[model samples]
Target: MSDIQLPEDDEEQQLYERETENTPETPLIRRSQSHESIISTLSAPPAYELYPPATTWSGRLLNFFRRIPTRFTQSSIALPTLSDDRADERSISSRFRIPQLELHPRIARWRYPIVGLCVLCITIFSFLLFCSIFFSPASLPSPSVPDKIANDTAKFLTLNIFMRPPGVKNNWSDYKDDRTDFIIRHVLPNYDVVSFQESFGFGSRRKDHLIRAAREMGYNHHVESGRKYPWQIAVDGGLLVLSRFPIKDSRLIEYPRGRHSDWMARKGAIYAQIECKPNSLVHLYTTHAQASYQQITSLWDDDVRTRMNQFSWLHSLIAETSGKDGSAVVLNGDLNVDAAVHKEKSSPTEPSEESSEEYEFMKAVLSGEGKKINGKVEYEDSWKIDLKDAVYESYGFHPVTFGDVKVDEYGMVVPAETVLTDADELMAVQSIDHVLWSPRQSNMNIEGVRVEKFMVADTHLDNDEDEEKGYTQVSDHYGISYVLRL
Candidate 1:
């Protein structure tokens, strides 16, 4: 190697001298001067230069080795001459080194750990979901009917009978025949016991009709009771329980007579206790409660209060009797009282004049709203039977409505007419009509105790005539019947 001399007064020397010199000038002037110098230097060719291709093995090796640190020093080695561009290339190469590992194997091995972790997470999530579905209470099964009881009991028959007897002027002679024919034909052949309501006793003719019907049906045990009118002729609107079994004891429970003159025409309940088996007795209660009356009248309030007291008394009496005898009781009747209607909630705001008048009438009869009848004796109205539970046990015992009467459409029953005029009366009628055993006959499991089919027996009643006339033909309500298996 030899020491080389360069030309004097070259562009590079000029640029260096210009950059070193400083002048007291404005910032804009300095920046412009600096920019001009930079452009001139960038355009000028290199003062000393050498060229070498980067593709050579030795060159690449040298470039590769320059990037790594070493413990030994090689200070005696001569430095290679390189152009500014070549030095830039070498500097870039020195910054990064190619890894010695295989590219495919590295990628394959890298994916394994990620894939494994993902699979493990998925499996854990699936296991948790499965456990939640199977072990939760929502997945539990509902109770089914017990197989043991189903296999033992035979299917019992049920029958419903309704009669709208023709008036005495129409056919007085055939009344007994028609009554006897119904028992022998429709009732006795189908059911084990027949329960009757609205059994009119206008004279010996009506009594003879029931007696002959019971005789024809081979029902040796029968009962009938009623109030005697001023004419001394018995107005036979009483309940009768006819059965093949012997009659034990029977009594008519006279409900509180409403002070209203119209209420006197309505009848109270008939309670009976019949011996179905040697050591077992089944109790029967049948009645027709108060009728629907107009509002702003004393009759409407009196009827509601009277009916409420009647139910309270009946419940107390039954509770006492059933408690004492430990007997399975069947309390069925044509209770004209509407449970759904009584339980409705009304707003205090004044309605339209027409609706307000009707509502007032309904409120008078309802007296105390939400006052439930079939409830625990201790808690008053606090404990009432859930309607859904009661209907589930008995299939046929359902709410029936005439005309536009609806029950529980919006969780409350509403009748077409609260007041009963001759034309609107028939359309206004609505009732539960029939309520089966509270706990249901099929659900009873006590030994030597069973309740057979219980239903309303007014399927045959013709409801075509005008309200008053039609109501008088048969009782305004249906009758309840039940058979007990002891």
Candidate 2:
């Protein structure tokens, strides 16, 4: 291979030699030479040219904005200055075209992983959203009506007014007004036979207020639960059976005993034989059994056990009172058993058996078979009723929530003056409140009597303290109604 070489020019070689040779020159001579170089460059004509004035008035107006200098950090682009001769190659006034960027190898290596992670996140979110829509426990639809009867209907209503615990309702006679209003507006006009739990008053005022409301509302006949002296007690144990018809031979029976907190009240049963028509007579038994009070750690807790006893007692009372009278018999009240479904987490202190955990009293009521304390009630659930009104149907029933309340066109909150929907309406399960009728398959003539319509009032107001929060109802539990074709 030959070594490559280039010919050297004489003038360039001579200048390099002169610069390499060190000269002891004075400061004044160096200064004069620097000044002369600056003068020569400044005197030269400019190579680049500014763009011509914009032709359109709008474009010319932009010249005012161009005077403002942009800081380096703010400027996103840099442009190259072209020489005067190169200006003919391209127009400076034309728009700057975007160029493709050459990404660094390090950044390009991470691009695929980032895209994969984003897709994975989106997929997971979509799957969760899909599951929420289809599988959420809330918003479960109520069960369809078992058998809508084609017979004539006799309306019956039963409600737990939450009228007791007068101390709780001491605020401006809160529940008192609600009870009166509901009876007059909703009950009197609609229901034929009405039964109320906790209808008695506190202190010396037993039936004065409720009696007035009933009479004023046109419920002329009121039967006290079978007691020798109906008006003797202090709290009235607050159970009363009011009839639009003649209440014949009606009485009240107190449970043998109550458990835990229920001992405070003389809780018991109310039974009435009503003449629905000249020939049509129906026996109605109403009772508020000892409540389980709250969460039961053990199925064998005193509350559950006592409630069982009360159930048996109630069944016995109904059997003795009605006794194959051939007349239709109906039972109504808050049994406090989660009938359809209950899977409460058992307390560790009390190991829970599946049988013991859920109320066994419910088993007896549904199947109409249990301990022979009252010799078993042969009653069936009203075609497995469902449609809210069931406690434990929801995590907790809070009536006063700031839900999507109706609003005016001006965006003001339009408050409701009355109860719109009752408790448990959202849950399509019958956890507790019910209407038990003797199935009339045996009575061919009684085929005309059928349970027509069952509805639960949304009695729980959104705000318990604030009157404006929810529906104006006193009871935490909803009132139950039925259209019984007599």
Candidate 3:
């Protein structure tokens, strides 16, 4: 305890310090401190452990194998770990581990349904297109033979004849000779039976000319009954039927006189019976009744009324005499009375007092009012019937009048405009020329009949003319022809 003097010598002091240092700790506190220092150094956490695991090598390896199906499954499967920190992080990582979808599965499930839907739509459209092509109304087939036959049978016979001798001037002598020549060269040569109106002859030799002409033309069976004027200036006059067939009977029927103080005389119609075939008879009538002009309307009315009476009478006669015998009746000629008057409802241009009378007469005739003769006789206006069906069919026969003729071409008789003014006038003028027959007689084969506007060439007349100036012909009316096959 005496002053624990320290050695001063350096080497001898170091040896002495080692010896003292190597001795067991003298204090309990110092021994504990030494133990604590050793333990702290040995138990200290590594810097690498503070951070996340070094997954570079494992991650690379896992990604490499993930492309394969089996490896991908194994890699996606969560593995259980022992580290508390790693376990906590695993929970979070698992939340984000989204499952990869298989490309083949998606395509396989969706492809067929989409394709089927498209195929169904295409099939439906194709079926509709096929049906439209084959079964549409516009694609219907042609008419059958039976339909054609029926249509043909319903048709009418129409004929147009021109009887003007060529190279004849507009003189009376020339006119007479030309007419005679026409009867011989054109009428007799071409037709077995003939009906003519406006058979005007020139000079003082009227009767002689007509008789001679008729005889020469082989028309031994003839009827000539019409208004005869003193100076041969007869108006609203006509001729009758002259045929090669056997003549059975004949008569003249007169028309009514209207309120015309200035008219010269009443008009008339001629009816006759001709043996057209073996043991068969046909009624034939001809007339030149009235003109449609306002100045002559009263006269026309008178003439039309009378003609209607005659028509009715003739029908009765045929029904009584021939209809029972199965004989057909044909009323042919220029009645001057139109079968249908389309303008009955309209007012006339430059109308006069007599215009109304004429309209009434026309309306009466067309409406079948004045057609009665003896209270029981009935005659169907064949022209009207044929016209009604004209829109659907070409019945072949139209009357010879101003309405049926065209200026650009030479018609059988005259330009249609000269006669027809409107629809009413067209109906009236169209059937003015006709050859009506009993449906039961003449073999009644409508299909075999042909109606045509006799061409001007056939009548030995020039048809071509200047379009602006109209036709250059002789007559004011056209000639209608009917060809009936018995």
Note the Cα lDDT for every prediction shown: 0.41, 0.51, 0.44
Where does model 3 exceed 4 Å of error? 1-180, 200-207, 226-237, 258-262, 295-324, 339-400, 403-431, 441-474
- lDDT for each residue of candidate 2 in 385-483, tens digit (9 for 90 to 100): 111222222223212211112346996544322243322232222335555666332231222222212122443323333344233433445566666
Best by TM-score: 2
Could you tell me which 10 consecutive residues in candidate 2 have the lowest summed lDDT?
395-404
The best-first sequence of candidates by TM-score reads 2, 3, 1
TM-score of each: 0.43, 0.48, 0.44
Order the candidates by lDDT, highest first.
Answer: 2, 3, 1
What is candidate 3's lDDT per residue for 415-464, written digit by digit as tens?
Answer: 34431133344423344554444445346432333344433344554345
What TM-score should be assigned to candidate 2?
Answer: 0.48
Q: Scored by Cα lDDT, where does model 1 land?
A: 0.41
Rate residue 19 of model 3 by lDDT.
70
Which structure among the candidates has the greatest lDDT?
2
